[model samples]
Target: MIRAFANPHRFMALSRWLAPACLGVGALLMVWSVWQGLWVVPHDDYQGGDIMRAMFVHVPSAWLAMASYMGLAATGLIWFVWRHELADMAAKSIAPLGAAYTAMCLATGSIWGKPTWGTWWLWDDARMMSVLVMFFLFLGYMALRAAMETRQKAARAGAILAMVGAVNVPLIKFSVDIWSSIHQDASVLRLDGPAMPPVYLTPLLIGGLAHMIFFAGLTMMLMRAEVWGRRGDVLIARKLSGA
Candidate 1:
């Protein structure tokens, strides 16, 4: 499957339709889920209450922050091993989006924490600290890639860096369990099944799906642009050399 997408023609053909389809479906689902969460679902009786609504964005952003990094690792691996053009483009394109998602997750988490915990930020929480590190890794990868003069060299460096930084993904996932943390344990992804009620869980699931699809669509569009942009650069260089 990875090798199949390595072919540019196949990738372009699929992305032409798939990108728009994903964006459309994702946007619709997000609207529906937000409406359901805000207007339809009853507020929690606990301290969380209506404030928990932030989870609609916070949870999905956190999940995608991890997911996008995993994608970066996969594409980076493909580029490192096979030197596939599409894979390189994909890994590069995903970095900024992953960074944006991570930032959103942290910001929204702080917003929720302020009301519930009576504090906007907690330096001691393992989960919080780990995710902040993940965000910095994204920034570092982008900066490192940009500092190189040649795209190939940049890609090589970025791919290696991304793979190495992937260690943070697992840490972010299990940080609450591995160390002392105020963050709640996994509720939606637990082995015993979701710990939350149906009313809250349903919207959360939809929101997660929406974020995943939107990220896919956005990533594909960026990959397509990178391919074209690279081709244009090659053409310009050839013309200049001829002149």
Candidate 2:
């Protein structure tokens, strides 16, 4: 199945329609989740009025931040093992988007923390610091990829780096547990199920799913654009060589 879509032509054909469909569904979900989270939901009595609502965006973006990098690592593995161009393209496309999400997570978490943790930032917190490191890794991957003179060289370098950096993913996930961090413990993915009430958890769930769909759509579109851009470069090179 992976090999089937390894063909760029097949990937492009499917993504052309799937991308838009995912985008539409993602937009609708975003609207619904935002409404459910911001207006419809009641404020947490413990967490300072409505300010706690930032969790709707903060938590979801953080999840996507980590999840997106994991996707990058997975594709990187495929490319390294199989030398699949589409997988390499997908990993390349994920770098910026993952970086953006990680940055947003840090920013929003800072905003949410100001009210809840009484500070804009917390260097002592394990979860917070680990995520910052993850964002930096994303930046490093992008830089390394761009610095390479050839796509083949970039792919090999990127794949190795992505796989090595993936060690941080599990560290980020378990940081709160490993250390006495100020960040809240895992509530959503607990073995006992979500600790929050259904009312609060519902919008969070919607937000997470919405972000996932949006990420998928956006990544596919970016991959398609990258493919087209590279093809144009090749054509120009050929024309110049002929001339």
Candidate 3:
């Protein structure tokens, strides 16, 4: 199934409708979850009154930030092994989007943390630091690609960096567990199942799903634009050569 969409034309065809469908559904789900989170759900005094609502947005961004980097690495690996041009395009597209989500994660985490943790940032916290490092990895991947003079070189450089940087993802996930940290341990994704009740967990899960679907749609749209831009470049080159 993955190989079937390796052809640019097939990908374009599939993504045209699929992208919008995902975007629309994701938007609706986002609205529903946000509405439920902000108003419908009751607050727990344990986590933080009213402020816990930010989890609707923050948790999803954190999830996406990690997920997107993994996506970048997976695509980079695909391009490296199969020499798939679309995979390279995907990695390129995912970098900026992943960075955006990572930024959102950091910003929201800080905002949620300031009142809860009594500080704006925690440099010593392993989870926080690991995520910060992932954010830099996203930025570094883009910067490294831009530093290269040619697309082939850019892709090769970006792929290597992305794959290597993927190791940090696990570190981010297990940071709180492996080291002493102020951050809370796994609640939703745990061996003993989610610690949250359905009222809170439902919206959080929905919000996460919404972001992932929305990100996927955005990726397809960006890849589509890249495909058209590459085609235009090819045409321009042909015209200049009088082909």
Number of clashing pairs per prediction, in order: 0, 0, 0
Query: TM-scores of all models?
Result: 0.90, 0.90, 0.90
- RMSD values for the candidates in order, in angstroms, are 3.6, 3.6, 3.5
lDDT of 3 at 122: 67
lDDT of 1 at 82: 94
**Residues 36-151 of candidate 2: C-alpha lDDT, one tens digit per residue:** 88899988766667887887888899899988888999999999999999999999989999999999999998887776667888766666777888899999999999999999
Regions of model 3 farther than 4 Å from truth: 168-194
Q: Tens digits of per-residue lDDT for model 3 on 24-48?
A: 9999999999999999999867776
Query: How high a TM-score does candidate 1 get?
Result: 0.90
